[model samples]
Target: MTTPTRARAARRTACAAALLLAVTALPTSTAAATDAASHVEGQLPSGATYMMDVPAAWNGTVLLFSHGYTPAGAPNPAQNGPDAATKALLLDRGYALIGSSYATTGWAVTDAVPDQLATLSVFTDRFGEARRTIAWGRSYGGLVTTAIAERDADRIDGSLSLCGLVHGGVANWNNTLDPVFALKALLAPDADIPLTGLPDQAAATSAANALTAEVDSAQSTAAGRARIALAAALHNIPVWNQPTQERPAADDWDAQQANQYQAVKGLLQIAAFHRRQEAEVRAGGNMSWNTGVDYARLLGRSSVRKEVTELYRKAGLSLRADLATLNRAPRISADPGAVDWMSRTSSFTGKLTKPQLSVHTIGDALVPVQTESALKRAVTAAGSSSLLRQGYVDNAGHCTFSPAEQLAALHTLEDRLTTGKWRGTDADSLNSRAAAADPTTPARYVPYRPTPYLRPYDLAHHSDGQ
Candidate 1:
């Protein structure tokens, strides 16, 4: 069979292995109650209970996962789906799996970590008694995992941040600015108006929503969606195929890759820059042209806090609105644009000083593999470069690894955590398996087209046949 066919087959085999292992992993104590292996419910913190699987004779290596963020009504907001699949895979190998619904639903980090820890504490009290703990989080969860590692290193043994938002603050972390501008740049001819002007919270949201809505509309038409998806595929191919330094914003991305511990100098450089900027702003500085600072002032911290506080109230996320007030400042922005700008190499590089492993699809559109490099850098900087490892998968969606590749990567991580060994990137295994899956057919490399027809990047950026 072709490489793609082989890859798909390997993935299937991996999934089968995980399932088989899960079947045999039930604790002897609960073997008779195998059906009870999963005890799920809502509880303390936010009453956001979870579904979990506890294995027999556990190795005491607990993997706590933090789910990625999506809008409130996202189609498949089920953290349990991936959690269950992963738990079964790991449980069979003598590990326990636990997932927490972060303290809040939105992207704000103020209390998200604390609430997650508290929930973890609850999980520990009830099921796991492991002294060794590893945290795994994706996207938003990845950011929270780093923050937790920074503050509660004593409680965490290691961290695996995947497709995490390592960019500073909530604003820059979301890539609000680039997505808008990129879309505008690419779709200007088709767009009624150029998507520019100051970042008015209302206007920005309106524009994004409008664009997203259009994409959604076009998505209903197979031909249109197919064309748009093709364009997206083309945009990512270059990043995957090009050398790291040759990629867009390579310096920014490389800075992100330097380990936090080893790169104290770099961290200090950026931190000092942030501090200097803060001072200037406090001294009546002009907000940089990039921040759209004037527009930011309109919604500012106070307004965002109120909005988020109320969102928390509605979502049952356990965080105090008073905390928002206490933390409010001009520098404190939750705006997606601001967050994305700052996230490049701020909090993670300075604060994260622990051994960690990160994996990402080279072609990820949301959280670029570049961010994963940043996490690896922080680990290396911490002087524990030996303790960290990275794996890149080919022809994969954001975090969707082919079965064999996923298994190999996880095995590598397990080996590191258990024995402190290093194996080079597992990209080869994944590529091999992916190739095998459908030697003739490609895996899903294209993104979904916008239904209503929003802007997308140009074909020059990626590899799909435009």
Candidate 2:
């Protein structure tokens, strides 16, 4: 999943940045600084357990990072992956590193915060005295981070959400733009209907036959395509069909179970299902891997609601037979009723008066740029747009900070937090202007500039600002 070359490059970049920052901030003849390594493990309020690492020369500041959904019993990916990179970056700067498992993976939100706070409480006791603390997360971790920020503003000094799903239940309840996934969601859940143990050939044959029939009966219309497109966007994947994209296998279906423990995995499972389905179709085999079936089955129903005109049209099927089934929507977990949690209350970006900065990639495939956009809008809506600074990089990936500009952005964030300064970009300016007039208006995001660095560089030679 990672390589030595990339890790080396990241380390060099972070080290150089830390050095520059230290050179400017530290006394020329600095006093001896003590460096120690320690860790703490405990249970969270939500009845979950977590672990954290604190540097010995800690400055009483903490940076708590979160992990997204992963396979059950999987090693915490954040600690060794980006968490290592982040720790190497901040630990040298005198910040204690902390991380927690969110109760169980998938979508379990019940114990998410209690678990995190529990970790924080243990840290406060272990480290003794803290002046500053901030929360940060990626993907589902982002959602967790946001939820924490919303309810525990007093505890969190600042927050950074990266490629996370902040919108909550909306994206899940909806169907994908891919017609196959939409059809798959129409499946009815049955305890007796064993799928995983079936021979691949047999399952493929059954799924393919069902899918083909639906396709033949679908109402091919422009509105139908638009509906499908929306579904695809929700899943963060491209539409499937004539091009033959793959969907994940049956067991992978476990991830799509959105019931608290597997929400993140469920999303990944959906992606895998689509990829596999595409592969199978391309290979001229049965089309058994269907998202529509998974979604419907989860909700305990066999078909989509008739009021879903857009879906029927997109499927391009003869709707006459299923119209009656459609009149009464299937009782499924994917139903809008099952996902009312997102709309229960409008989430605020919180009091934006504090110095804040957001960094994002223009081409991130997983978390759309829209998450940041919504956040910016919320801040602007609160008339605190001036307090936020945003940075975008064209070629970076998730939580990725590769370009010289991104390095500069981190410096900018550090400066704002410690010095109470604020910076602006064209995108930030545009967002501010839009929000000034209508606080409730949505945030408009601009992509990053596209340009390759002209320098032939090594980590030692790289320096943007810090």
Candidate 3:
């Protein structure tokens, strides 16, 4: 399994390759004419950059795209859509695409919600109102897209959230913190790693590197690997990381353990430590806690309990001592003010008023497939389950859908909106449509149900203390 860091680098390389292909495939004059006729770029008063593209034969429908999170100080590209292939296909099919380089990049959900709306306002003011509008986003952008669908249902017709953290903010952050808390208790009890409130990017990166090194060293032994599996299970990290391979078998201890270690390391460094730091800065303190949590109970309820048991049995070890140690360790507590702030700023109450179609990779480690489950529960509780449909691709890796898969999801949502009912959304049917559209990349759709979220922020759903 490729490490999370390496997988990200590979995605960047693939994007570069796609950009190169897009450039070389088009004649220079044709490219220039297309840009001249359809492309428009501008900036909002708040310094958010935006770009819009409309085809010569307008379809009267617009796709508003919200991009994934960008780290602070990273270059914010004016991406008009999710990927090169998707963008090309949308334009070819005569749908207008628009996107905003959201103001203040790192975890900018507060700014993104309004900034994206502002960009849409600008588009309507200049080009006239779109006859139909669909809000779409990937990863973090998916959360933003859902917020828009909930808050501006009258303005948008439908929404597509691809690999989004739709489980709401409190649950996402608390779940991320679970592994870090477990790692600290079981692996580095004496290490001076600040789990939250990092002063800056340098501090967060330094902490992440330190945690990664500890995880790397811990992977050398069977007991250490068992503890890592405990942490991974608490967060619902998938046992597969490679996109081209099937999930490792239960008894394939070596392969399964390696993937679990990677998941733990990646979650601690990126999601728990670094992202938590940024989130703490926004929330004014730590918003995650494990106070009064029962480690033994958490382990028993974990989806990967059987896998952990198998690993311990193969390694001639017992998990009882480790779980006891975790139970005895001092637990972290959240500041009340910070918890309130995060709850207000991050969580979604379902409350769906528009048609929403969410797509996720079955083996997404970072966001995890269980997020979709949480969202489903939320929508059900809100009595809007009729408005929601979720589809999954069989591949591993986060947001790793091919263009055909993505377009097929869009078409599925369009079908729902047009017919007022979901049509052909089963894995076989969706995969057949995707394959028919683009045979180059075979569809990997499967009927895989994810486990329930382990550390949901909702007290009713959480396994541990509220």
Candidate 4:
């Protein structure tokens, strides 16, 4: 971990350049064909349930799947693949798949890893030893996969993540905090909108409704829109919102703000209002704060800074004055215990003990592409860059990759695991491989480099802006 000064310095250095990886094609032996499949389901000692699928003629390779976040008390059903189509395809191709319900669901990282390992043990007890186990996870489960990659690499041959929050829980929450803090500061300064240290869901819901009301009202005026743009900039919310709509043209501030507004609204609907509150409970207190953040500098690093500035200028607003207000606004300080829990449970060392591949849509609103940037930095810092490869899709949603794309990534990891090194995994190669896997499915891999993840937090840089 670097000192606060050094961390901020590193953040600057990272934002100066982006990583634009080119694409390449792939070889398509995802798995060998198999016969009928058998189903297995059971529960762990921790109350988490698990499910598995083993083909009549198995390839001895097990794909250990980890599902994304499920709300607390929700129907925590077990998952053995990304979706039914992919699960069926993998089972048909002779790969055994397994996953668990996890003891509890909201931000279930701690429960997931242990539950997954237990499920694997159960599978081995029932179905016998797998020739090789490949760990795969999505969203928060992606964080679980990376943790497994680091702490339990010897148990798995390779890893794959989809739309994961790899920047760790601290940064993930901080990303949410930036928008809410800014929006509250500028829009509802006197409102009783609670941002952290929530006591229950009732408080969170009430606060969420209040914030949403403010943002909806704020969108109607030029002055209000300017302030919203500032908040969006600090949060690094992307200006391109609609997946089907063309990317907003440069200088189209109105179209851009409209798009950012969608993300802004989404930010309120997601982590800002719910997960942060939920996470505080999980961590035993608040896990996010903004005591020393530099709003102007943060905006400067945003991908949409130019658009924000344009909006502010057109609105005849003072960007400098607003930034000053943000800097001067009362800051939130995280509870030390909560911070410790988040750091220990969700942080990434970037040290990949096994070959890992991750694919994210370029326009992912929730788990932004910037997450990949932080991942690459961490990997590079740990000198594990060779053990990782990332690809981007030309799509614009969270965990939105089609089955073909998902399989293509799996095949790539399989190739690396089978061989002692990686083959073609570039955007072009991934797109081509995905098309080969399923022509009907769209494979929109494209060359992309993401800006540095703003406001990244870890134990080493725990003081963050301070």
Candidate 5:
């Protein structure tokens, strides 16, 4: 990755401006769908839009798709599911596909869960009840789907969450806060980048730009690189997926650092910074806190700690001082009322009454792979561990999976539903199944373990503060 020099900074600024314009240019209201012989579209009284596609030969099962987060002002896709190929594959298999654009966007868990249920109700009312209903969601939709599974298990036969934030809302927000806090302490210690309570989009954008500049300046020095590595480690941001660039090998320190620099830069500028502001607005105050967080402890417990250490060693920088600095920095606290609101509106209980199969990319920077571990722990605590199965893709990026991988996952869940047992879930087995399903898009399943979440978060606390 090239250093974020003046030219590069200018390019980044231009790109951000272009993105802002594009987002703002989107139509405020959802567009009316063009109905086809096999497709149906409708809108609820609340203005939430929904679309459904049925194959000529209808299968008994319906695949309800919950889409990921849509940044405010961006146009929501008319149909459900992750990509066009997945929708095509499902339709070819004779399954029905349905999805909804919740009435409002931006941290819309409150609207999404019920809006989706309303969509299901409309679907059932239009056509006969599906023999089996499988709820599947990607990213934020994954959280929505999981919530449905827990609270409305009777409505669906099974569930699949792809790259989902199954980790409770509190944990998700707090975990993101880790790296942003580190960036502030190490790079822009005195910058007016508010970690919370962003007054508006302009304020959020300013903060994001400031942090991005800091990251750009720091990318040119060894100490700066080492500090970034620490920040990335805290969030387990993968040192892969540099834009339009091939991923570096695991042991390639220089290449990995470059990739990590890009990752951290993006995280601070858009993923963590901008998204948190939107979330704060929806929650009515700041919902994330780092008040009592211990940075050293967080780093020690991180999945990328070893990688961070190696990167620091290669950069000839002392990691200890940075850790100490983070420990001494003043922390941000959350508004209790806002925290409670987010907890109620979002978060999962893990009390699964139906089988759920979750698929995640091992190196997902947006929603860290540790989210799976946190979900596993919650289900175990709820005595619903038996109902949950997780699969990992040996790749990087957020929700980066081929149609083959997704079809194979759906099949895996279908198998459990059909035979009352898991079949072909091992990495090798799943890869084979995915290849057979679609030889065009090869599978990338791999056996890997994810680290446990460091924060104290669970359904019990989020549900009612019990």
Candidate 6:
């Protein structure tokens, strides 16, 4: 089977494992309840560390937080909430918070699911069971939370994913591969840059440094910048990078390309290469392939095609020539074993039985906003659209949500769990809610509908054609 069958394959693998070790869910007990505020920390059999915060009031609800990616060799701190401000608010409101720092970092979805389940076990075993368990995650953790919602429906009540890579790992790596691959063919075709099969983290850094030099050099000329725009377009990466500035006007091609160039420099050095190397190591081999892709067809579907075209015309360069270069470049191949492993461990079925609400910033570059679009398609395919609601905040940066905006999304999910129907999820309603709740911070919720996901895997309800 092709990539389309990954969801079914993953679900089957998850179910078989679920049968081996039961997820412990206990009945709530007044006898086990504690009166005062408390904190608990412990390590699981896998050496994964977990931390929990219980409020004084004990509201009988627990919020499970799954954190984003932590690159290898960096400090992997355990998080009890998305941010400090959010953590304080949740605890002050009588909600218990808990999270785990998984066994290993970087592309850890294989360990994340079981680590989360074990954390829940530790929580329930110590205190009584929570009356309602809501699972929330940010970035990569958001992917983990959704996977849990799909497989452990009986344990988790609802979910909230913030700035998540919800399109799953395979699609993310493959999509990112496109732009960097194009960058190699156009900017530094003769340079010894290994786009894939990076042997170690050091090799990945070396490759990123090489590409970084190429991007810096390309920024000097209009022709080179136009080529860069074409690559960013193919990746569907947004061209807005700065947090203090407003999004560039649609007609401002130079500003957009400038943003793309700046944004892409860091992306290539960090996420595009570092994460790929780690993932390939964990998956036992390369998991991305670009063997038969058509570059022009992808550009034809991109949202920034006009921007790219206008920039190329102004630079007196042939857009078609760059496209030809990318098409003729040798393609990367995926290992069958690694592909199968990542599919079962890192991909999502979107077969959710629990209610979930996901929110994304419309201007996100690190984890592109279009991931939400891909997720909705996957959920709909599993016949779970009725249980899913999505919201958008007008902002930039990855997981750069304010306390107010974050709380607003959380409250909406709570309302859904209470009402059993989605209401007031529109931008106006959410903006009003954010302002009413936290008047100090600014609210930027806006109506948004993401464009077609350029690398959507299996969101169509019926077949692999999507």
- Of the two candidates 1 and 2, the one with more favorable TM-score, higher being better, is 1
TM-score each candidate: 0.54, 0.53, 0.89, 0.90, 0.89, 0.91
Better of 1 and 6 by TM-score: 6
Error of 1 at 222 (Å): 23
For all candidates in order, the CA lDDT equals: 0.43, 0.43, 0.79, 0.82, 0.80, 0.82
- Candidate 1: what lDDT? 0.43
Model 3 over residues 1-466: C-alpha lDDT tens digits?
3455554565466457652111112221121112123577888988999998877666767889999988766899767798888788778888889989998877788888888888888777655567778999999999889889887787788999999988877788777877877787777899998777678878888888887787788789887787788788787777896565557886786788787776677676677777777788888888878887776777776667888887777667778877788888887788888887877766777778889999999888899988888888778877889999999998889899998898889888998988999998899989988887677776877887777776665322433223
lDDT of 5 by residue, 57-80 (tens): 666678888888888889965457
Preferred candidate (lDDT higher): 1 or 4? 4
Candidate with maximal TM-score: 6
What TM-score does structure 3 among the candidates reach? 0.89
List, residue by residue over 1-466, the lDDT tens digit for candidate 4: 3355554554455446541111111122223222245677878999999998888778879989999988766788998888888787787778889999889879888888999999988876555567789999988889998889988898888999998888888888888888899999999989988888778877888888899899999999998998888888776677775576568788889988888888888778877877777788889998878887888888889877898888899999999998998899999998888988998899877888899998888777788889998888778878889999998888877888888899899999899988988998888888888988878778988889988788876443433622
lDDT of 1 by residue, 289-384 (tens): 223222222222121123323333544544333223222312222333432333322254434445666666664554445454445444545555
Model 3 CA deviation exceeding 4 Å by range? 1-37, 244-247, 458-466
| Alpha carbon lDDT at 324, candidate 3 | 82
As for lDDT, the candidate ahead, 3 or 4, is: 4
lDDT of 4: 0.82
For model 2, how does the per-residue alpha-carbon lDDT over 198-277 read when each residue is reduced to its tens digit? 23444544554544443333224433333333233333331111112233233332111111112222232443333233
Candidate 6, number of clashes: 0
**Model 4, residue 102: what's the lDDT?**
88
